[model samples]
Target: MATEGLRALLHSVRYEVLPAKASEEKVLAHVPRDVVVTVTASPVKGLEPTLDLTTRLAGHGYRVVPHVPARLLRDDAHLKEVAGRLREAGVDDVFVPAGDADPPAGDFHGALPVLRRLGELGSPFARVGVTGYPESHPIIDDDITVQAMWDKREHATYIVSNLCFDPRVLGEWLVRIRRRQVELPVHVGVAGPVQRAKLLAMATKIGVGESTRFLTRHPSWFLRFAAPGGYAPERLLTRARDALTAPSSGVAGLHLFTFNQIAETERWRRALLDRLGG
Candidate 1:
């Protein structure tokens, strides 16, 4: 039954939250104990918030994965300090990304360099996640992005796809990954049920500059979805579910970008799961 499948899927889902805006108490209050949670590092806000949030989350007994944006790290020394702090907080997993910052902060321009440094540190985390673009990235070319993942696979435990609306793109991308011999399991990204207007407004307010690239790549689709009417992630999920259920697909799970709309997201997830008989 769908409910059984939903329950199974829930065990693997990781909910993402912005560390800068999410309060420890607020996060703890909203996040269920069973779901794994990840804190994102904002390029503009720096890494302190993520560190603080992760520490608190770990203290509360939630499995926490903190983002380590390459542009925010200053050097190997900074990396060591961050790792030390995370270890002290009983945190392990991390999601390393090239980051949206315009200029390089130090020696690491991308996740590969930072991941290499983490490897040298001999951290204890069993998992390390890297970003993947199921659709075209805003800035990087397809070839470059593909190579980046291939290069990071040695150090990364999984691939979490960037947000995308098209399930076909995701499905085909997964096939391509396997064909190319990039074997890391994938966590498909989906925005939780969001109001179209709200998504657009938030998108603009957040100054997600890279979104321009997404828009450029899919202008018609973007425009159609940008206007009134709500946005349901089901269309994408339907496709992802098929891929995930396939024996040879190698898809891992879902990474819900809740956009700090925790209550609504949780409600939707729970309702859907229950409907699916989870």
Candidate 2:
């Protein structure tokens, strides 16, 4: 039988996708309507592609979430416009992150400002997510990241941890957050069934500074993903079970980074659910 935490996580999981050309088709074909789908925003694409995908997905009856990266918005007006657009599209959820835009598009430079703005707008969305770092962010200090969470707690509905491989670090992070009193429910970010080669290639193509930051943040990535045959999502899940299942951890669910490998990720999730008797 599935343990309570595992079952709860599987049931409330979210699949994160990019706003790529084929992403819509892949998600429509593979992901069930019940699963929450989150679209990522990037500096190159601005926020249009992410918004377009989210609107279309929401129309298709998926509980869609679009990333509202702080640096992407030109100003408060842009933030309001984005919020209105999402509301009109029937979207009730959003994920806010400090984007990678080198020269920020405008006044907002980090997630806290955007989150605070959202609240000032009378909290348009039903669910708002903010990023948490189990592993240290390449550009920000670990203490600062924790402080950011503390600052954003009142505005956000939950926390979604950035991708982390070390279960030890993840467990320690839970302790740290609780001790610090950052009490938002957390959705642990985990990689889906993506190939190592694809991840490596994507890492390189994201730009020199970004690639360097990626490597700095994930130095052990190769070693962990290089597991003889292929990396299994279960290994991390199994190891992190105790930390996740603990009542005080406040882990709400899993945010599966599909990396646009929608079908493969969906298959893996289903198979794992079956095996766990979920």
Superpose all Cα atoms of candidate 2 onto the true structure and report the RMSD in Å to 1 decimal.
1.9
Q: Residue 52 in candidate 1 has what lDDT?
A: 90
Per-residue lDDT of model 2, residues 156-243, tens digit only: 9999999898899999999999999999999999998789888887767555676776767677777778878777888889899889
Estimate, for each residue in 35-95, the C-alpha lDDT of model 1 and write its tens digit: 8888887655678989999998899999899998998898889988988899899887888
Clashing pairs in 1: 2-276, 3-276, 3-277, 3-278
Q: Candidate 1 regions off by >4 Å?
A: 1-7, 200-229
Which candidate comes out best when scored by lDDT?
2
- Against the hidden true structure, what lDDT does model 1 obtain? 0.77
lDDT of each: 0.77, 0.89
Best by TM-score: 2
Backbone N/Cα/C clashes per model: 4, 0
